[model samples]
Target: MSVSIDISGLSHERIHVVPSPLAELGMALHALSEPGHHPGLQGWATAVSTRLDPCLADRLCEADFLWRSTFSDVFAPFAGLPGQSTLPGATLAEELDQLDKLTDEQFVDAALEFTCQSTYSEPDRNLLADPAVQRRALDLAAARGPQQVKFTQRLLDEPPVVRAWLRKLLEDCDEAFFADTWARLSHQLAADARLKTDLLRRKGLAEALKALSGAVSLDESEQLITVDKITTGRTTTGSGGLVLVPTSLGWPHVMVLHRKGWQACITYPISAPGLTAPPTVEQLTRRMAALAHPVRMRLCRHLARGSYTTSELADAHGMTAPEISRHLSVLKKADLITTRRRGRYVQHQLDISVVSRLGSDFIEGVLR
Candidate 1:
């Protein structure tokens, strides 16, 4: 439950806590370890919106659970903070409604909740206070399990106790152990991206090993971390990254390092999972390039889910009606999404088939 660490080299300066409310939700759910609590982060918010609150939809979607998990996996360990549990009744209701509806707005609202603003801005506070935002969140709550509202309210009221644990983890461990922990944490994060439910199951660990097996660094420098060794510790509440110590039975493991007096553990070999094939640097370059325009990337993710009317998609992204139409037109030209006119509305879907063809011909198209 505790460890000592000294990480003078790994300062918190390099650690950039995720600023998105949706990511906080992912971290929160991952912390809770419940499965399918909220639809995978990104487009699910938008998709959920279509189902839960038609009036409160927007097109400004965050990365889906999978994509957001990729980032959270990297950041959660370093950013681990103490957990406090407190939730306002109205806020909890709103959060659940967002989850049930899966509105793009849900992702924004959730990300905003835990995003490290450091100083609260009046504009930001006002946005949150908007009656439309509140109504939509309430609607989302209505769509979830019976106790969702209560649970959410409790969470908003207090941060979890895990932050103190992370601080303790950092203070007790050394640099080498810290690095190993980082790797373990990274692997756990990748597997988690594909994991649909929030439940921290043994299967998630198994999948992580499988992902690492593709490029196991047998190099003596990368410590030989056995599968059994990684599974021993109960993962902390907020971040999905595991915490372990050398055990006599089965396998050997150790705690990751953090700064002196800090209880945090750092892990390495950071990477994402569920790539159809291992990506080359070139492929990664292209993917990054594709995401240069935030709006375009958002559109691609929306299409990945299924065909939706332009209006339907627009509501999810938080865009003006005309803005949505313009983006769709651009995407169509890029061959990323295909559209069909359904009388009053034009529906669009991801052109994965085309993307596959493009990749085969050295013509990379987007939609990861």
Candidate 2:
């Protein structure tokens, strides 16, 4: 349910938020390969999925080996990839070809080693020699899928199987969907990077990191940071400072990849207008329920012109102040509006972005 990162000794200067086209590509491939599993992506990823290689998609769905650090983390950083900004295929091919030199042993060892370690730390050399650790490694492999289990076994036995298959999957992913995905993300990625850099210069590292996502935060005490996750797992020590990457592809949820001869990174959703995550079922229902009420609709119409106080809204809508306050409470809880206190009076303002996103999601969700 959480990954608590202790940052007591780390300097603020070391925590960074940057963009990486390569990591974005890796996440997109996995997400596009399995869109139905991610509710936030299901609406828009349909069009993108139609362009993907079906066979490659199927293979990735069954291959956990591809996700193990040997592959994803090992290949995550392509320092120049983000700067390419276009020609995703050309850039991807260039990076993959360069990484092709990673020996079958090197890649397989990293992959196999990842399953045994508790964190992103280096692999134990004698892991295979210990029966208990070996069993855990096998159990982890089998949990993925039959094909992945086989891939893991083959990699352990031959190690060379890693070379051709991994490269092929990476390349096919590019040929299928990387270009279109990059085009969708290019402008936002550049803008996000610039904004974070500016924030760092104007405010500080603390401000810059805090601005990255609601899911991530550096505590005021600065000794610890908390990351929300689906299931609870053991906390890992920070080997290196954080590398914050902003992207549109990783919607709804954020992902953490620890540093292993590379930067420890968190690739988060881009804080942009067009690519907001689909609201949760509760959120959708709440907002819908708010609109369904005639009284709330009247309130919304009045607030659309400008912000209003509880008393003002009641005055405009011909309702008791207490009754108007109740309606305003519901609308604010649904995230359709925001309340800002100004001395004695609080102003209720419509969240215009939420209005646009609501319309877009309603249309897309209904049609989908």
- Highest lDDT model number: 2
Q: Which residue runs does candidate 2 get wrong by more than 4 Å?
A: 6-15, 53-58, 61-72, 75-90, 93-106, 109-132, 220-222, 230-241, 259-262, 271-368
Instruction: Give lDDT for model 2.
Output: 0.60
Worst 10 residues of 1 by lDDT: 244-253
Best by TM-score: 2
Q: What does candidate 2's lDDT look like per residue over 69-127, in tens digits?
A: 22255455332122212121225666565455454434554556334233344444334
Those runs of model 1 whose alpha carbons end farther than 4 Å from true positions after fitting are 1-133, 136-269, 272-323, 326-335, 338-360, 363-368
Residue 25 displacement (Å), model 2: 1.9
lDDT of 1 by residue, 228-323 (tens): 221122222222222311111101012132221112332322222121333444554554455457787777665653456666566666688798
CA lDDT of every candidate: 0.34, 0.60
The ten-residue window of minimal lDDT in model 2 covers 79-88
Superposition error at 177 for model 1 (Å): 27
TM-score of 1: 0.28
- Measured with C-alpha atoms, the lDDT of residue 336 in candidate 2 is 93
